[model samples]
Target chain A: MGVTVLQIFPDSSRSGCLETEKLHKRIMHLDAVQCGMFTVDCDTCYTVTQTGNNRKLHIVHNSETPTTTYAILDTGTKQITLSADYLFDLLLPRLDFMYQSKKNLKIESKGAKYEIGDFVVKIGTVTMSGHYKAILVEVEYLPCHTPALCWSLMREFMQSFMGSCVKPTLPSYLQNRLHDIHTPQDTVQQYVEKFNEIREGTTFAGTQTTGSGS
Target chain B: MAMPVNVPHVGENLEAAMKSQIVPDQEFLLQGSVLDTSLGVVIDRLRGLCDNADILPETFHDHEVVFVLKDFSAMSTPGPASQGVMLRVRRAMDYPDLPYQLRYVGYPELGNYPALLRNCLDIPVSNNVCEFLTELGAKLDHEFIAKGFIMKKGRIKVTVFKMYKMGIGMAKDNLEQMTMSHMVELSVLTTKTDMSVAEDLRALADQLKPLVQLERIDYRRLGP
Candidate 1:
């Protein structure tokens, strides 16, 4: 196994550029990746796994903290663990939205003993790692577009994907929702005011209008 | 034939005898049979047990926990369906001896299943392969559009591994179905992990806590 180092040069200050250039020249002299911890005038360095897929392990930089979170991928186990601070923080918020989606998708129908949605809502099964009492509250069918082409143009890949999918005819409004929090609610009472607010420009996805709530 | 229904007259838990209880041909475990599958009787049967003491809490009284029958579609194998599901219902049922209502919902009917499953075991319509073998073409067609797997040589394959892990494995054996990825996802959503494990235990001692009024206490030292 050979190690290759990719570093970014930060030239925010021209005064340091000359010195940086000299250092850059020195680094370029080493075989693709020169080993031994020697200081390089670079903004960041990335360590990537070289195999069938170059899985990024980590990236380091001069800043006290760096970004682009590292996904802890145990390929053998096929488990993705987000140990990075920013990544973990996003999980709880996603969960809150997921719960709300479950609440909104509760459809009612005829004399059947129970609605099909009931199976999706059954208290949701949570694994013994999260802190909440509920898990998998429900499956939402908000306006969604999953790669689909007419049967004539559908490729084998698309066929495979759709084949595994529970392709139910969902609400048209659901397509635009696949990503938003206010996408769907139990009723329009929850979405009405927000819809009116966005009516002027018909916008969502982080754009706030004149009438905004904290 | 029929499981006993426990109620006020029966003033105690009629613990379900899962032991040596091999139900034959899980054909109509939950489905409305010519022979009525009185689920209400099953729910009534799981009511509170007598310690010669405790009863339901008076103030805010409702079933705190819900029971679910995992990974069932047609019917249970007509006997010890799956220890994984059984062990769980047993653990939760007896957990703290907290009296909670139980319900059973089959898996595939997840459409109706999850809802009916609000928290209990459900019998399935059918599960035996024999029933489908003759209707083999229909099975493939159903699995094709719904499951995206071709049962050639009897091994299922999918474009995505996640679906493969869940749809197929969950039906056969739930134990293998629940992977760590599955757990972390659940933990993120429901926050079911024991809170005590997240951080140091002693650190919590300093916080001013709520006044305690011991409500219902039913602890059974499970094993010797």
Candidate 2:
């Protein structure tokens, strides 16, 4: 519905709680109103080798858009995204012969949501198979649809609370879609990209391994 | 007599509840075709036999893309080989704003029934369905354009359309006809518990008797 930017808040202490609390305090200091909670979960299904070449399918569901299901198919070469009604969930089990769901690979991010003026901030704790993985912060600028037009203003707003972790430039996902009208699918795309990164045990962007933090 | 009367009422209530929650997935179908030259006469006949005979039949131009997902390893297996599931994506060419349709039709049930019954699911999907299906390893089998009239009589849908081959780069203009006949299909979607609708489909097909003999033509029986 708007331009959404997903940033990975680094967990230097290796415990996710402290970083999330610190971010929460900074956001609350900005007179932001706590607005319930949010969640975005993804289920990965891999194509059976007997069917063809191996591929990955990511089925994502966002609490904000409860009635919709976003399916991103990674064909090893390119990614194709399909947004369908929530009823699409029923069709997944029928595709078992072609794509086998990796039950243990299920990942989700859930945390408190905040509203400040036209911006909505969500700080989610990413967990894979119930194990703490990382921290993800999602900021959505409601008034603007094009990331190209709102990137600067959003960066300033994000920097107010997220500090240096907020990048000066657009996320790579938004770079190609800077001028395009942003949709809910774009938001989920960012989540899938970050989820995949966290799954691979990679370092978060804009964070140093200080090794000592409360 | 008293017990039978009470049982029907209870069964009807349960059936209604189940219908409210589950979509009808069984499609009872009958197919036949009329020659291109006789298409006008058949359309005129349908206009009278179908519902709302006063209004003109709704003409449609749809593009259908067929995708197949097959397990390559199944060819070597000894048991009944997998025929591979086929998914069809259909969108109206005249109405581009309408959502694309994703259709899954299973093999016809083998029985002594008067109509063809098969498991079917039709989901209105986003425009990105083609790309998603391809990414799911469903190979593009073929595509064609179907232009014709669609009429409805109660729950039964009657469609008489002619298929055309796509031009270069999937161009719509200057298309070539696939056959000399206009394929006529009479279908009704019903639930698994109800096989009674098959008779309705048969009755509708019988009306087009002389002009176009609609029958339960088993596609698999028609050799490749």
Candidate 3:
């Protein structure tokens, strides 16, 4: 019912022995879906944080779920994602704020997207404005949501493949918020940060040349 | 000589002291009104621009029955805090018309602009809604039928409707339409984090200039 996600990167390839027990190696296939995400705001605010009055709203629509709209409100330090069948009710008559964004970022993945015992691995690249931003490797332990409760177990699992990249620290957004209820918005906040970081005109050094899966 | 110590006591005075120091940020509400004389003409113009309109005339038939509840708790207050609460009832469109819809619509608080950031909460409509409101001492003030046309130009939703008062002992066919004007409201609900779309709204308003004056109207200033 819960999940613990770890972002990973590919470094050195293991030759023979490590590849034998790899679940993905035998199947070597996964049903991958291509996704494009765009973050929009009323031209006046940057991140939701700047929209200071009582509520800060952000709209992120993904191409994979073209019909579904995500409206996030950041109130105080708490972020509430509105769940409704009619999300357009909040988006339309764009009167109070004009929704605008520069471009949409695409995420394509490869490498071990299948489950390895209790963990599922996702190796993907995020691209925007025709440039690759960063390679994000996410490993999720399907059973737990609280990182503090299962950090050691997640670290032990990811350490098998990600090796030293498995830093045993939680994302800072979880600080003091570890005990709070976890929702999909926690994952959204992570993507929003990466989307914003790329939107701010920072290239991933020379990594811009890497293709979708490299 | 010992120095005199000034220690503040923690009670009503302390609470008031803390309240005075914390000021909430201002929200803005932008609104405009139009007379019935220009309703047809404005709607006609809106319909002409295909890229600007989705004029599903009947889909805008979002009929609402509004119930106003007074905060008698403020019976002692002579100020605006003594305002009544507004609740609405209607048939839930998504579900079979079995359950009625219930919601609380608060008046817009004073803010920086013509647009208001009012509080609205939706309560599930069930058999208990009536009993619950009754237990809270809510009274049925007046019920009206709001039939209107809603369209969107980009992100802004423009709602134009004429309110009709339910005639006493009236059948479904006997509702009386209020004759003053057709209320036209242009609004877009956004998170408080977004920037004001005043410039875009103003631009759209400019397109309909001279035909009708679309600007912010303070309902309070209009009087009860």
Candidate 4:
């Protein structure tokens, strides 16, 4: 509904919970009222066809919008997004022959939500296949819709708790859409981008652990 | 058929509950096309035969795109084994702000029915649907513009429209006619439990009679 910025909080302690707690404490210090909880999950399905370039379909669901399903199709060249009713979930299984879902690749971010003045903040723990992976922090400015108009205020608010992790410029996703009115799709796209990064990061880490063990 | 006396189990009742909640998806359709020279006479005849003859018929301009989803592995097979599933996306060019429609029409039911009956589902989807279909591996088969008038008589909807070829870059203005005929479609959407609507659809098609001979048309039989 408003401009949202997603930032990947560094987990130097190698513990997802410890980093989440630190961020939680810092936000509580700002007198932010603890709202309920929120979640954003992504499921990846890859093309099984032998011909043509490989493609990925990312189906995302946000707890805030319970009845809506957002599907982002990642072709090798461009990405396409479709927002449909929850019934779209029922249609996925019928396409199993062509697009097979990777059950182990399911990723989700779940955490406490907070409201401080006009700003709503959520600190989520990213987990893949039930294993903790990283931390994702989302800040939304409820009063403004365009990032160009409210990026400065959001940057300062994010800095109050997130510190140096908050960048001076907008995220690359928001930069391209700075002048346009932000929609819920924009928020979900950011989640997909962050989820892809976290997915690749886990694979990279998996290789390192196996190499050392061998 | 006798009614069961015992209470139905949860699994048995689940299907009944779903049926009660969802709207009808079966459509009884009859189609015909009139030549461009006789289009005015057909419109005049439809106005006289349909309900509310005094009011002006509702006009619409829509663009339709057909996409087909097929498994490449099945391409090797012969015969009609792998006809693939087709989904049609339609948007009203006149009403740009309205949501686009995604439609799936099943093969006609084989029975001695009065009209053609098939499964149909129309869902309103977001704007970026074309890209979504392509990503789903549904190749674009063809697209065309339909300019028409719609009239309703009870549950039956009669639509008479002319197809136009989409110009380069999908230009709305300056279009070329795909044919010298105006296609007329008479249809009614009903539930699986109700087959009575097919008779009514047949009656409407008969009313148009010699003006436009509407009949059950199996497009697949016509060949590509």
Best-to-worst order by TM-score is: 2, 4, 3, 1
Per-candidate TM equals 0.14, 0.82, 0.40, 0.76
In the range B1-224, model 1's lDDT, one tens digit per residue, is 12123211110111122223322111111111111133223212212211212342111111121222222333334432222121111111123344222223222212221111111232111112122222111122111111111111111110111111324433422323222210000000111222232122111211211211111111222355
> Predictions ranked by lDDT, top down?
2, 4, 3, 1
- State the lDDT of candidate 4 residue by residue for A117-153, as single tens digits: 8999989889999999888899999989999999988
What class would a CAPRI assessor give candidate 4's docking?
incorrect
The TM-score obtained by model 4 is 0.76
Expressed as tens digits, the lDDT of each residue in A1-214 for candidate 1 is 1111111122223233353334434323422222112110111111121123322111111111222122232233232322232222222222221111222221110010101211111111111122211111122222322312211122221122222122232223433443434311112211222222222323222222222111
Task: Between candidates 1 and 2, name the one with more favorable DockQ.
Answer: 2
DockQ of 2: 0.16
For model 1, the docking class works out as incorrect
* Tens-digit per-residue lDDT, B11-106, candidate 2: 233346456745577899899888989988999999999999999999999999999876655555542235566889999999999989888888
| Candidate-wise lDDT, in order | 0.20, 0.83, 0.48, 0.82
| Native contact fraction per model | 0.00, 0.32, 0.00, 0.30
Q: Taking the tens digit of each residue's C-alpha lDDT, what string does model 4 give over B1-224?
A: 23223322222233464568444678999999999899888888889889999998999999999998766555656532256677899999999999888887888999988988887777677988997897677889999999999998889899999999986866677789888899999998887777888888888788787888888888779986
The chain B TM-scores of all candidates, as shown, are 0.15, 0.86, 0.66, 0.86
What number of backbone clashes does candidate 1 have, counting pairs of residues 3 or more apart or in separate chains?
A: 31
